[model samples]
Target: MPLEFAPANADALPLHVIEQAGLDGWTESQPKSVVTWVRANNFTGSIGQVLLIPGADGAPVAALVGYGKPETRARKRFVLAAAAEKLPEGAWHVASGLPRDVAETEALGWLMTGYAFDRYKSQTPAKAGLVAPEGVDRTRVETLAAAEALIRDLVNTPAQDMGPDALQAAAEALAAEFGASCTAVVGDDLLTHNFPMIHAVGRAAVRAPRLIELRWGEAGPKLTLVGKGVCFDTGGLDIKPASGMLLMKKDMGGAANVLGLARMIMALGLRVQLRVLIPAVENAVAGNAFRPGDILTSRKGLTVEINNTDAEGRLVLADALALADEEAPDMVISMATLTGAARVAVGPDLAPFYTDDEGAAQALAEAAAGAADPVWRMPFHAPYEDLIEPGIADLDNAPGGGMAGSITAALFLRRFVAARYMHFDIFSWQQANAPGRSKGGFGQGPRALLAALPRILNL
Candidate 1:
């Protein structure tokens, strides 16, 4: 469903957001009849609770949504999203009470709650159009929400419909929409182009592997993004258990997220010479599949011993990062659903990012707070560098011990790029539903990056 904004003249119902502490003062402002009705209905201000204020006509004239108290951290972010989900179908506008920033967040939340992955399903979600609150940029909110929806759609799709070829198609479509130039070096061309690691990991799949590149903007500080696009990870020879393979389709979530961020950058016309690289592939089982013991040469000329074939995301990303680093862009951001260790450490809600730059880390933290996108900084611990080294090769694809899996993976990819880089180990799938996010594919790191780009690129 499209993210809807109410017209100025539209008869939008008023949405009053009240904190539990202010409930008494709020009731004083309400009509006696309405206040009595609310009391009779046992309406105490609770987070995510909603009360419909009735007019003389016996229809809801306004909505009173509880934001809990000021100390309620969970409601502090996207409090009004619950109202969006429960509100009767029609246009609604926030009533005056909220802080400007809070209102803006509420507006974005409303749009986010409208997202539904109905590609194969026939049931359309109920419409709850919201008017852009005062001081909120409607265009920016819509662009972000749409980009997130794009990410969700791409990751939610099954492997049969979201293979390597399909991923390229999605990238090309996004490029076309933004008037950006896009190209793909597919099949054996990956080898000819010196993306041998990418080629080696993906050569066994029926759908050939490819590097999808997109370029946008004419003049500005160069910003490059690299995403691992393993469409379906059967784990190659080190195949995952049946349970482990269930969500394999989301292995390409990194690619989807980068595309989503690319869409936002181009759509918002950010002043940056943006370049996106996605090594789209499927790590499938075949006679020619890359083996755990195989040592493959990367685009950067580093040899990696495949300690585990399941660790294919970093292989593809390494080659792409190398290609990205040749230009020596001001900054390169690489994202991937790389390791289960990340999930174990930070859980599914928070994206764990690694970078050596202190200023960039601070900016990311601030941006994450501002955008309501959660990210935790994981160290690029110099001590853990030894863990990635195997005696036989320049690096081990999978480290010896199970410890610091995310950090070791980051260290492996760090070998390829010379530019200031940040690596995000993200769990793209949401295991449970939340206010604005559903229990499906979700975008991580992009929103935080988007918020930080202005300062990071000095744009």
Candidate 2:
């Protein structure tokens, strides 16, 4: 369901404040009192604890929530989200001493707590909900958060239920609802259709790989989005360790994100011809899997050596991107859960993108700042292009040295892209749990891109 953030009602929830520890004597005393009260009652905050005490009137007032071990916490980034998770169904105000910005960010984060992937499961009474905080752009926050939730849900599902055929089904369903046109080229037909690199990568998987395309809008500037949709990466013939292969289901996070972005764009009626391309594949192992040292041609007609079948994402993307590049749209952006190197560079929360367009970079920077969705821009270094050089072919899928792996990956992809483009290397899973972030699959980077779109496209 689309997320809805209603404007915070002022009259209904009149007085509230958010307070940090060590702020003042009352603030310091309140936390101690709350803790003491919890101990005396033999209640634990581990399962989440909340207590309501008498206020100025005879009626009960705002409650105190115990968020365990503030010192060990990494910034209490989503503590307010806990409130949404556990609070009873009702409207409430922030009544302590949180800074306006922090309070607002947390307010939006709280709404995320309501998400549940019950597609295959039955609903429980513990289902959560919340009203948007007062004086905030409820519509915008709901739109963005709901879009992100959609991305996370799609990525979290196991590959058996989310294979290339299923991915195409999803695209068709989404397109039908949004009045967009959807088309796909599947299986061996990929070769007949000139998506050679994509075909080579997924020929091994039982589920036929496909290039799912959706186009929406007209009478406006063009924006093309490409997503790496490796439904499950078994590292191809060069298999990964069991640990490395554990979460391969999330390999298609980029595909999920662009679909989520498509949802938002169509819902908002953005002023652009939005084209989404997703090359969905399962990088499984088999004799037919393209082997290392094999030369494969790309949609752009560039031959690449399979230096490592593990580098299959860029290969499939190369074909899809070459197709998108054919139009030289005003903006071409691609998202991928592509590299571990990116995680080392910027961690999971901050996605790293490469682009030579200064205006686009600055616009994204400013948009992220305003939206509180942060991102960092890496470079499309021409000098590093040599790293992708192959001894036997025009380019190598995986370079021997790990130095600048993410940047080199971007550079490799750059070889196939003819127009100005940006590539996002996202670590699409959350390592540790937080209020709104659960323990398993999660969305990354797309929210920042959504926030940046209006500014980048001058909407």
Q: Cα RMSD (Å) per model?
A: 1.1, 4.2
In terms of lDDT, the best-performing candidate is 1
TM-score of 2: 0.87
Error of 2 at 166 (Å): 1.2
Model 2, 1-459: lDDT tens per residue? 234543345323322332333223334456565456435755443214555554456454555454444563344456667655665554556555335565556666777666666767853322334455546666667776778777877887899899999888888988999899999999889888999888888899999999999999986878999999999999988999999998899999889889988988887778899999999999988888889889998878788988899989999998989999999888899999999899999888887888988988987887666455667999888898888997778898899877899999999988878787889898778776667776656666666677777777777
Q: 139-174 in candidate 1: lDDT tens per residue?
A: 898899889999999999999999989999998899
Question: How much does candidate 1 score in TM-score?
Answer: 0.98
The alpha-carbon lDDT assigned to residue 111 of candidate 1 equals: 86
- In order, what lDDT does every prediction score? 0.89, 0.77
